[model samples]
Target: MSDTYAARAWLAAADPDPAHAELWLTYTGVALMPLGTNWSAVRVQERQGLRVASLNGPAIHDGPARAVYFLVPTEADWPGGMGELLGGPSCWLGVPAPERVEPPGIYWLTPPDGSGLLVDPVALLAALCEDGADR
Candidate 1:
């Protein structure tokens, strides 16, 4: 199977009903770094010179909430002590089906591209700090 297809399947497996477009609880293979606010999350994306759809890795946005979750490798060290790092066997993340990119519920802000690319922690921290300093 193609990488994209495999990646899609892997994510879809997380959903109890892969046939339906809905959010499901799944244990993430990656560590989830949640930004405190959507505003800051967007700022970090902008700093990376990437549009929402062009983010290097998968990111999830909680509906009507200030939170955004950036997916990074599970083995990655914490990102400079910035955000809370949630991962490991005990952590469960709400993941939307691979096809759920639009709103009405939790969705992918940036879907995985199958290359397993992830957001750089150092860059994320730098962007966040820059945004904070600008305030």
Candidate 2:
């Protein structure tokens, strides 16, 4: 069988810092791709209109589930950090993926005021970290 883990879809958040990200991964049973490897291994997105209640698994393709959502830090309107984002039935933070860990998948984006079109993480990383951006 494939080496993928089976899990219900859900939004997960890292502390956006090295130490907290590490601890979050460990305590939640999610696998870490190592320090310098996170760029290529872990998927990240800005944010979107994903309904938090419907997340059940990865999307039909190599991307995020339709119901998954994320917070973006690069937006000029971004409230600075996740702490400023609102959490509710559709958005959340610090929660681990539902069931088990799996290979990194697509991450969807959301805006700062919790509005607007989603930003692609790949594009954001490329513009921001030109030196080590993932393809």
Candidate 3:
């Protein structure tokens, strides 16, 4: 199967009902690292400067919570002090359909490109720390 198809299928499998909806509860293989909106916005802008699409990975802008959730590999050892890392069997992320980019609700800050790429945890931590110090 193509990467896009496989990725969509995997995401869809997370939903128990799997119906067409604005959001679905999905269990991702990657850990969800939620950072404050300000910090995440800065990181996103910085990553965009590199002009490498995959470097930013898949991220969600949770409008209600005012946070950005960055998807990182499950094995990545991110420091808890940096942000809350939600993963494993108990955590379920509210994922928007691949097409949901606009927002009156939760939306993608950086949507998945179907390459299965994820943000670099090391780079993320470095950026957060550097930016955190300023704020």
**Top model by TM-score, which number?**
3
Indicate the TM-score of model 2: 0.24
Residue pair clashes in candidate 3: none
Q: How would you order the candidates by lDDT, starting with the best?
A: 3, 1, 2
> Between candidates 1 and 3, which one is better according to TM-score?
3
Error of 2 at 90 (Å): 18
Better model by TM-score: candidate 2 vs candidate 3:
3
In lDDT terms, how accurate is model 2? Answer: 0.29
TM-score of 1: 0.61
Q: Tell me how far the alpha carbon of residue 66 in candidate 3 is from the true structure, in angstroms, after superposition.
A: 1.4
Backbone clashes per model, in order? 0, 8, 0
TM-score of each: 0.61, 0.24, 0.65
What is the Cα-based lDDT of residue 130 in candidate 1? 62
* Model 1 CA RMSD to the hidden true structure, in angstroms: 7.7
Whole-model lDDT per candidate = 0.51, 0.29, 0.54
Expressed as tens digits, the lDDT of each residue in 61-124 for candidate 3 is: 6666656667677677766666666665555666665556668776666776666566777877
Clashing pairs in 2: 9-56, 9-57, 46-109, 46-110, 47-109, 47-110, 48-109, 48-110
